[model samples]
Target: MFTNIRKFSAVVVTSGAALALLSACGGTDSASMGGHDMSTMSSSAPAATAASAQPSATFNDADVMFAQMMIPHHQQAVEMAELADTRASDKEIKDLAAKIKAAQDPEIQTMQGWLTAWGKPMPSGGTDHGMGHDMLGMMSEEDMKKLADAKGAAFDKQFAQLMIAHHNGAIEMARTEQSQGSNPEAKDLAKTIEAAQQAEVEQMRKILKRL
Candidate 1:
């Protein structure tokens, strides 16, 4: 009887120890799960800064002035080119006007966009370039009216002369841009304008001689 009671006591002790070990294991698992939760908790993400967003092109005051002045200047050239129908009789003169319009119209838009992107004001429209001004070779109201009233050989001759002068003014402005402007794109455009207008000036001079 004593032997059976000793075996029963031993079995009870072993079961109690096993139960304690199971409870400890469960506690350890709960603590480990809580640590995982803590690891996941963090502050919200940061807001996007202006620098992180898209950047604007770099430019300077000279570039701004170039675009501002050139916009209106190109507009006038396009307008003069459009007057070829009533004011041009030479087939070459008419073709040249059309070409000028085609080139300058888009160039005007591009300059306007540059001003807007740079957060600058657009220039007011006018053709009253005074004597000794940088905006030389711009036609006066009287000059345009005279060309509009002429026809045949007179129209052809007047158009050639005025357009030649107009191109020279553009070349001067472009040279200023090329020399002092800060924007790479604007400078490149200025260079292109100088070359193309110089060529056109020569062509117009030749046309004038023929007329």
Candidate 2:
């Protein structure tokens, strides 16, 4: 009878261990299911983000050229605007100069950021990235020098004339970007430039008539 009791105890212990092992395996399987679901969600999120980012990330040669060419164009305009602080005779001209400087300065930084992102070089030196005379409405060295020499009323008139041409050139370049560039942000910037500069050109023309 004691031998039978010992055998029964051994059987009970074995059955209990088997139940515990089974329970552990079930818990592990449940945890694995939850983990797989989370992993799937995490993986899909990046794919969605990449898809959304694709348009802005993609750019073409025109977009590159637009930014490259415009940075110097804007720099020159800002220089011209700076001259108005001391050189311009009219309050209108001074106000306009301030406006131009404010608008174009941020634009310059923004384009620089783009070039950096694209691994493209900034236009070297004071010139328009070798576009030179071919770059429409860019002031000649002589033209800038002459403007610098002038003071008061003469400076205001010259500033208006030169800036009208400058604005026209920027508008053309912006239109080109709109038509040919692939990047959404660049094209949008181009459009903003075109609209804003066109309005400024009109305002300058009116100012010219008054002068």
Candidate 3:
């Protein structure tokens, strides 16, 4: 009877060891399953972020020049436009001035952003005519003085004529940029300036006839 009891005890101990081994194998499988899920989650997250992001556009040197030169050019136009607001008597002339200011101001900011991005200066300073006749389509000191001093219909007529010439000069510069400018943004802006200024030129000519 004692021998029989010993054999039964041995059978129970062996069964307990087998149960422990099965439990350890199950724990390892659970950890492996959790690790696999974590890896999948990590891999998918970056793809979601990339899908949501916006792609940036590229630019070149011609684009940079177009932005830089046009900023100051537009500034000068804005200044002239403001003068028309205060000094012009004709409603049409004032309207034209306002239009010029509205169009060029935003463009100036756009150019400044380009310059900042391009790591370039505001004006490259290759052309310097001072206050002389050499300046391209620029109003002389005397010309500005005349505009500042004129009154009523005379001021309106003169502003329209001078601005027509100014727009023409801008068109010429834009054409140069179109042909020679290396940057895409600059070339595109040049084309825009050419088209818009040409339209304004025709409008100014019509205004001159009415005046």
Candidate 4:
């Protein structure tokens, strides 16, 4: 009977040890699975953040065309404004030209930036891409030459007249942009251009009367 009890006790102890070992293995497996889950969550978070951080390329074709066409348009205006510094006799004309140059130079750079961001081509070398005189208010090469040759009162009158026409053309373009453009920034700029150029046009008309 004593020998039977010793054998039974050994069997019970061995079974208990096996159960303990199994419990430890189960705990290790649960910890490993939890670690894997945590790692997956951490990795996915950065990927989500990266996706959200990327710039929204929400621009449409109208935005592209507006930027492309306006760059050259602004460039020509700046050129005309530059001529006023040397050729214009009226103090008002000179001041107006300076203002035009200052406003348009920055605008040209801004439009260029938009084109670059959109992966669209810029107007080459400040030249309209065959758009030429067909573009509203664009002076022909001949017109530009005449302005370049004139001085004093002739320069001031011609400059004011040409600039007035140019501003009208710009206002028309801005109106089109406001109607058609999808990008918020581009539409906002179009509105600004329309209002500002309209005011300038009125001012120029007043100046024309004086001249």
lDDT of 4 at 190: 70
TM-score of each: 0.70, 0.72, 0.66, 0.71
RMSD of 4: 30.6
Expressed as tens digits, the lDDT of each residue in 1-211 for candidate 1 is 1123223223323433554465567632211111111110000001101111112486665566566666555666776777887667799998888878777766766677778887877765454443312234566666777877888889889888887777777777677666656677777677777777888888899998889
lDDT winner between candidates 2 and 4: 2
Error of 4 at 116 (Å): 1.0
lDDT of 2 by residue, 128-173 (tens): 2222423445676667888889999999999999888778778776
Off by over 4 Å in 2: 1-55, 128-131
Candidate 3, residues 1-211, lDDT tens digits: the string is 1123223224323433553465567632111111111000000011112211111245443344345445445655676788887799989899888888777766666666667766766653322213221223545456666887887899999898777766766776677666645656555666777777788888889998998
Q: Given candidate 2, what's the lDDT at residue 105? A: 73
- Cα lDDT for residue 99, candidate 1: 79
Q: How does residue 180 of candidate 2 score in lDDT?
A: 64
| Evaluation by TM-score, superior candidate among 2 and 4 | 2
Candidate 1 vs. true structure, TM-score: 0.70
lDDT of 4 by residue, 95-177 (tens): 88888787777676666777777777765553321223344455656677889999999999999888887777677767666
After best superposition, candidate 1 residue 65: deviation in angstroms?
Answer: 1.0
